[model samples]
Target: MNQDERMFSIDVQSVNLAEYSSKGIVLDIGGGGEGIIGQLLGDKVVAIDPRSDELEEAAEGPLKIVMDARELKFLNKTFDEATSFFTLMYIEKQYHQKVFEEVYRVLKDDGEFTVWDVTIPPYPGGTKDIFLVPLEIELRGKKITTTYGVLWTKSGQDMNYYIQLGERVGFEVVKKEKNKQIYCIGFKKKTNAN
Candidate 1:
């Protein structure tokens, strides 16, 4: 389980959350399962998830809220930093735009939104992009092969789509990292002061 956790957290580990400061608030989207980022950020993080059972399993410390990402219940410009780790794949494509809008709406001026997720490889015909990726792991000396459902957009849409969306919603792409399995993007909310 520990190895599996590390395997899934590769992208999360790439972000330097310490740069945001322990005092700053970070909203972790779909972070209730392991709350690894929350655990890393301590009291500075607020993790939200629609699954109450997962929320209950989160380690004690970070504030946990049961909510949907499509419609966040936060005031405008409320969060200094927001993060989404491998979350978009599970959501239907239609809701993605709304969720992006909500993330932009709740971030403070100059606030940053960091996202780490996988982009699907192109398939023939391009009608569908979702794929089942097989992952092998060893737990308690037994080898286990598990599969994860992944959604990949045709072409570079997986990464470009969010960049375009951020531009549309008043955010500037500050950093971009294209890793082996996942990519990371950081967008800073643009304000008149800038």
Candidate 2:
């Protein structure tokens, strides 16, 4: 297969990420590139990404930080909310659990963690080395369209994968929505009383 044939784009409907107001600081993991969450939440978001260049590419709104998701630098119960908007697909499968643990640790009691990601199927044999999801994000009466591509490998992820990981890290699934191959999940950190 040639280079062109190595890339596969899925046919998915446009996913709308509506703008919402937040009461406190939101920790946006992998909040770089377009920085969708940062753009939506403005200064209330503390966006972090592992790569400096990625953070540099993000729009000016959130407080950008260069940090790893697996080991967050914030104190326990620091953030009121956290978000991962189409970011987890970039992380390797082995680090996902650690990322969840770190997110759970840094969030305050009853804090919410929302995630938006696509369902990626396992890599089929042959030269399909890239899987791409074209997203048309609708926010605050504007539209931003982009394509996120990741290397196609053996791992396959969906809503259930995240739900189980969140549960293992003491998060309760409060909401789940699916739009075509994309999904949104809202998870609340479980406090002792609940």
Candidate 3:
């Protein structure tokens, strides 16, 4: 089949995310589109996305900025917390490490960084050119139904992958959970004992 005629639908289970709230300012990476983090945190979130249109499409609650995750414009140890809600899957795999490092640099000592993402298996040798995942996200007593589609590619993204990245970036895992293909991980920056 031709690329235009090829498509694959991924079967994903519904994920019920626990209620989360931050005490201080939160740097929400790729918090555009649905803007779930911004909706939950309100003005306490500084939501950033590389595409201006994406930020414009998000709800009017956070202080939205057009910025890249790998090149955060804030100073070192600027934010008390950071989040990536299903955002890592959208980024190129090669840039994932840089994004983690940038988040580490911008977060305060002992600050928390939470992530929610899906595990995508390596592309099977077939005619499928696109992969689509239909998700039902339950949070704060609400159910959000959406579909995320991307071009088929080799992606070995799983919970273990993020754990290693967090460890390498001087973060200790504080929370970890997985529901089917979706996973949520919380990490805290290791404080320097100087």
Candidate 4:
């Protein structure tokens, strides 16, 4: 399927963005892909992605950076909030811990972090999650099949993994929401001194 026809959205509307809009700066990881979150949040957000080209599509107001999420360049306690939308699934699992740590480091005391991503059920029987599902589309009058699935299955992780990792990195899960295909989690950075 063409880019226009390709579906790409992770539900983050569950989080109360208006609160962050007035509180302080919010970091948006991978927003460069489509800039959907930045488009909605506007100047309150600064979006980052390693792919510079993708950032060109981001909405006008937010600051867009071509940087990797695993090692953010910002100084400690720089942001009041951070968010990742269906971004971790595309990154290798080995880097997830680092990404979480980076987010924690950049967030101010009492800062919040939110992530919305696909979930991998422990038991696959009734799951709507797809694994290499094939779709046939006509391109130039020729039929072509594209097999699509969540990226890096060998390194993909689940909601439980994130919750545990965040705890280890000084974040506490304050809220969680699950749907047939995805999970939305909100974590607040602990205030205790490390």
Candidate 5:
């Protein structure tokens, strides 16, 4: 199986989407629409993407296909584990918090939420200074912006903003860390915050 045949998606392989992912209704936000996990997990997933047909292929399988974000359908507290790998970088701040809020809403109490994404170095939290460095590169003899002074050059978000946003949504910061360009962000369902 080259790649398309074996059916391994970056969203799954990159984040260990199949193994660590338990047997339950795992939600894959923007799962490349191919949805390898739907098959790998077997009756344990609901793949949501803008193109509904992407998941339609897996209809015979145990996957539930949807054509929207977690907010569009599915009642609150509807999932066991939720994952957004490389998808959050594309998320806008306005809707970013809502996604986190929705994740909190959809996950059962004490459930775990994991996010895999690219971000700058110097973890814990980042200030503006860490983001203001101008990275330059040449393309076709023309200068192109490799990495901007902000997160937009990235998945369109600062590494710090996401961590803070998770806190705001009442999720206890179970763990947060960064390795090279990969950042592992973990948030547990809200409980006693007193």
Candidate 6:
């Protein structure tokens, strides 16, 4: 699935987590003005991404914005729910564990982090054209891409590797599935399994 399709799945997964809402702060990592989960949210939501220019134009009240995901400027235990939809995969695998640790550190006790990212494409070793291409969008006095597809040059590892990595970082395997796509949510746990 492409970015748009993965986004739709993230929306669905986030919607399915509605039962866990409690007015706690939610942060969307790699969440560049996406995730309609905010529309259904009853709590505060934060969207953090590196694309400041593109998302700045779409920013408005309540839905706050940030410039980067790796270097989140929030204090510890400042969030209840954190998400990285179809995001962490694009991140360099070497820092994958660090990313999970940061997410784990920021969330409050018992907080949940939902991740919806692509694992393997349709074929074992094949490529699927991305859907979110760079489209020239007219916003304000500037032209920009309403759609973007940069993963074409990227190579993603197998899905199970991420699950194992999350576990290594002391996140409990709350829920995981591979439906039409790969989806998983890991809850903070007390101890690591070494």
lDDT of each: 0.70, 0.91, 0.88, 0.71, 0.58, 0.58
Q: For residues 70-141, what per-residue lDDT tens digits would candidate 3 score against the true structure?
A: 999999999999999989988888999999999999999989999988888888767886877788877787
> What is the C-alpha local distance difference test score of candidate 3?
0.88
- Considering summed lDDT, which 10 consecutive residues are worst modelled in model 4? 9-18
Candidate with best lDDT: 2
State TM-scores per candidate. Answer: 0.73, 0.95, 0.92, 0.74, 0.63, 0.66
What would you estimate as the lDDT of candidate 2?
Answer: 0.91
Model 2 ranges with Cα > 4 A deviation: none
lDDT of 5: 0.58
- C-alpha positional error of residue 64 in candidate 6 after TM-score superposition, expressed in Å: 2.2
Colliding residue pairs in candidate 2 = none
- Badly placed stretches (over 4 Å) of model 5 are 1-19, 34-40, 53-62, 120-156, 192-194
> Clashing pairs in model 6?
none
lDDT of 2 by residue, 12-50 (tens): 558776746677999999999999999898999999999
Off by over 4 Å in 4: 1-22, 121-149
- Which stretches in model 1 have alpha-carbon errors above 4 Å? 1-23, 122-157
Q: Compared with the true structure, what per-residue lDDT tens digits does model 5 show for residues 66-108?
A: 6456374767677778776556655555678778877788787
RMSD of 6: 8.0
Better of 2 and 5 by TM-score: 2
Q: Pick the candidate with the highest TM-score.
A: 2
Per-residue lDDT tens digits of candidate 1, residues 94-162?
A: 787888889988988888888866665454443344464443432333343435555444443468777
What's the distance in Å from true for residue 8, model 2?
Answer: 0.5
TM-score quality measure for candidate 6? 0.66
lDDT tens readout by residue for model 4, 19-100: 3343678899987755656766778889999998879876687899999999999999899899986677767778889999
